[model samples]
Target: MTLWLCQLVTSLQSCLQNKIYDGKTLTCTQTFENPMCLTFSHHCFLPSWLFVKFDVSFIVHLWHVFLNVHIKQALNFSDTYVVHVNVFVSLQVIKVYNEDNTSRAVEVPTDITARDICQLFVLKNHCIDDHSWTLFEHLTHLSIERIIEDHESVMEVLSGWAMDTDSRLYFRKNYAKYEFFNKPLDFFPDHMVSISSETNGMMNHSQLIQTFLNSSTCPEIHGHLHAKEQGRKSWKKFYFVLRRSGLYFSNKGTSKEPRHLQFIAEFSDGDVYTLLSARKMHGAPTDYGFCVKSTKRGSPRDLKLLCADDEQTRTCWVTAMRLFKYGMQLYQNFIQPHQKQKTPMRSISENSLVAMDFSGHKSRVIENPSEALSVAVEEGLSWRVASHSLFLYVSFRLVPNEHHHGCPVCFAALHMAQPWFHSKLSRDEAHRLITQQGLIDGVFLLRDSQSNPNTFVLSLCHTQRIKHFQILPVDEEGELFYSLDDGHTRFADLIQLVEFYQLNRGVLPCKLKHHCARITL
Candidate 1:
């Protein structure tokens, strides 16, 4: 039994020895190769340990090689990387060049219109609103978005708003071209409403305004200035009172008179003292004169007269009245005569007298009253001078044609003819004929289908063939006259002309007489 045990032990020992030196088997049997397993050799244990040490050194070198390949590449990548980019805008393309006989790099304005940059020569600057502004027609193309986006760069190009170098910057090139004007920086909404009433004629005081003080009688004075008194003053103050007795309606509706009075007082220093006025209309003619009185410290009787004489006051009033009458007479006799002779003024009334002036006067007023009525109607519907009438007659049917075939009466009267009832016009016939006849600009009264009046007047006037139009508005009794010029007029009579235009169009024009003046409350 002992000998059998010995043989078994020897076999087990040889198997263990073989497993220790065989690294491949050790690797297969365990997750971690045993580095000290080869050092446990039965015959050469120490020498085997050296080879095991060499293997460990080789594995460490290989780990370092693996790290060198990947970790070093990562570090190098981090050192060279950039996440964002930067670029500089080209300044040359945005710079402007002045047309000099010199070649200096002039800074171009970012706001420049194609028209401004393209000009070949240096020109004198004018305001953007000046008549000469038509030169930079392309300025109409700029838009608000483009302007704001480029605001930082545009300042260099133009002189500024209103300057000749400045062109409109935010209007579209197509329809409805609107120019930008600077509005008040600090706006008070309440102040705007004050102006609104005055503009719309809805204010309480508007109806009271009348042309009572004849401009001709009033001596024109420069604006009043307030100066303080240095020494003893001769007069404390001067006052004016508008009284009822001065009111007298003129024969023509053009003259206006007020029923009440407005009195204003001013100190010797030219400062306003007070406003004292009364309105009295008792259904009877009231004749009265203005009373002037003075007052001292705390007197029981508050006033003493500086000058008091009713006859002298009346005489002064009469002299002023005479001057006004003379001025009116001068205008009617001298000025009006010249105007009438220069241009024919035709006045139409509700009932027109069939005079023998234009018509040949057939014996016993021949037949066909309809045809004569039509002729008279055409004259009433045509354009006439102001001396003729004060009404505007708008009509679609105008003068008659030569054919006598298509409302020939309409053609001669209005200078335009409507086709006869029986005639048929081709699609292009009317347009071609009108253009070919050179009657495109011809003035013809358009029938306002909106009118309800049966008997109306037509006023016609033509002077030097350079026609200018005017419209006048009169009150119910035709006593008050407010006149406005036609659209073709320049800014010479801007405020008055705009008022008429606005009224005609069913709107109120801004009441600012000039841009310089504020709309008074």
Candidate 2:
């Protein structure tokens, strides 16, 4: 206490002398020239003079009174002193880049990650609730960059940077990030989810998950689960194994035999969900418990609430159930996320795309294919310079055949139809198709709108997600040009714009590649 009090007032006299803080009083020696003699005022006596005359007890009593009145007023908030203290905070400014290259400053938390921050902006902007947004990490100093995986924290990525200030994170659409939820065929192979016709009719469900895991597969899924009693109130635990066929519990001890193992539930027409706050809400053993609820419009009592030992076990069981139920859709939802991030701005080189004019009427790639072959076959790829409507083309490499009957459209690339290089496509079907692919960046195609046939829409990928940008028709002095960036960028025709974006990087990561084409021999 003695030491603390001494240190407390160590700078009191000096601060009071210079008036650093308000409301404090000080007495100083009289100011004068060097030759002038000093004089003591009668009103303010020296400390020695006052102390020498008073008894020790009287001095202590006076000191107590002085501290009581003055200290309370000076220190207490209810008194005249309203102290405003400044706190120091170490903040790092992170610039968030939008689809249009516009940016906003995000006050990122120390524990923030790419996915968390993206969701923050999504909520703030009132964007769509699709879980396809992604964060792109760019190291300007090192001339290299990569996607910040959903599991990777932003701080962790920053820590690996060579230059702190120069490094940047790009947030944009990445449908592939969650495309598997829509495209199931690209993920689950035939043998993985199929019941073999040659094998015994009696299937061992344990071997189902093992086969999926062992294959050089489209998706990785496996985990442990607990099977509970059918009674909703009377709960009991039984260790179980989840497979594509259904949920099974080991009667003896982790038994794989059909006799020892018993079937519990199959998710063919159902879904599974993890129960939140199970300890309080459902009286579960652990809060990390889940249930496989049938979707057959049954009573809530029919649902089986199974509890896992921990979060990992619960998560594994739930994810595997979803895979078994939805199969390849989930895998397709998160496909080609790393390599297929296709923001319009991060696209191919700008000079590579070529624009053309479509005139005021409907455009066609080739009016007649047989006549074109005998006349000018290359005319089908014409760069129309019509004074009214416009056309464009992005560079595309035509592979003779892409994995058998599958076209690039099956994987979110360009769509081609003779006499109509680009046409209209339903948004749902487009989403279902793009997500089926790996969600490659710069994967784009042009199509007319169902509501407005006069104008067109450009569907493309950025950050592995598909975004539809409107292509508005503009008539400037008898000249027609289609624009997607609100006239910030324009093209003579839809084909020209498509061609331009393919070879050039115009708001897209790479040039156009895969296109649907038909040939007659």
Candidate 3:
């Protein structure tokens, strides 16, 4: 089947020679090996098709549509070449991060919406399409990134990217992403959604707009504060309230009447940052300090300085001020979590039970091609005892029964005891978990391989892809050596191997990033 398609493509390329345009002829000079074709029932007006080279699917979908139905009538074998070749559109290839962090550079039609690309992969990979997959446009250099909404175009998104090179489009899981839009309460915590005395000290979702609509009842964040006075050398503590009007402190207590209030400052058009030299600058409270400055582009000034009693208080005040300043976008970013489009593809369940095969590998499909399926089946039951002596066994230390403490092989695992590391997950589950927070390059985990029982597989997520490295053991001089690079670079044990890979990225895609941490206190 592949060969027949190859021959057909070659013939089509040879015949598609010249094009006549604007009375002057321009040769169809470029030889397209892997061309994409889109056809219209009537005729297309596309000048040409040009994009990154991708195999089979391009020709199957594009050529099949154009050649039989549309292009045959337009073909010209001789000069005067009166042709009306009407269909061809090629798409660019972008790397998509699969569930296990593995990357597949897939080509997609340039003109279609981002949702189309997700649907293509869902069908191609035979995944149960549940429609949660997404294409993330990351303009890393420009410091701008966002999930390409279902309605947006892939080419349009790429065109907006401003970078010399290093821009990327990520394909991964984002379940809670847009969930915030429908369920905003899940995204905004209680502290951030507080109601002040401005709304009679109580407000709900329905009342939120009504409360803020009237300037007189606008939400305000007020609390006790230690502030710097202009004329006074000594600092004094006062009851401070942040309202739409401005930051004000009561001359006496938490009194709202005009007589007892004094205006401190207003930060309608400025920004805030942590004051590193807080103690030296304005005698700010030690360690619990942050500063706000006016963003008057050219001119720089050491304006108003405020201090909080603790870091938490400082964070609350600064956050409230920011909510006050950039209300809409910031609030949207908070409530409307960046969600990816949903698919119909089957999602990997976290509770799916897995059992080991006879050879003691994670019992995945017979993946080690070197072992013949018939032979593996023949020796499947007794194969464990057969390779027992030669195979220096290494399994995941994250398993509950495995005592990681004081074991040299599990030094990294014991220290990096994250929840994701505690279980063996399939590629999709891994991708979903890693993307739950962010696709940090070095996020990684350890899982038992169903194909190889003598070794554990390291799943490292990097460059928006998951790379697998099999830990193999070699017995030399009565000592076991573990290696990922086909025994080229061997470590005394798994500990040394993990440590070496963390700092020096040898064969692995990227160095081991921080382990997934989950702490509840």
Write candidate 2's Cα lDDT for 351-396 as tens digits.
Answer: 5644333444874454465654644534444523332222222322
Pairwise lDDT winner, candidates 2 and 3:
3
Candidate that would win on TM-score: 3
Task: State residue 268's C-alpha deviation in candidate 3, in Å.
Answer: 2.8
- Model 2 TM-score, all chains together: 0.29
The C-alpha lDDT values of all candidates are 0.25, 0.50, 0.53
Model 2 regions lying over 4 Å from their true place:
1-226, 336-521
Off by over 4 Å in 3: 1-200, 203-217, 230-234, 280-282, 297-301, 335-337, 343-521
How close is each model in CA RMSD to the real structure? 39.8, 25.3, 15.8
Best by lDDT: 3
Clash count for candidate 3 is 29
Q: How much is the lDDT of residue 406 in candidate 3?
A: 24
Order the candidate numbers by TM-score, best to worst: 3, 2, 1
Q: What is the lDDT of candidate 1?
A: 0.25
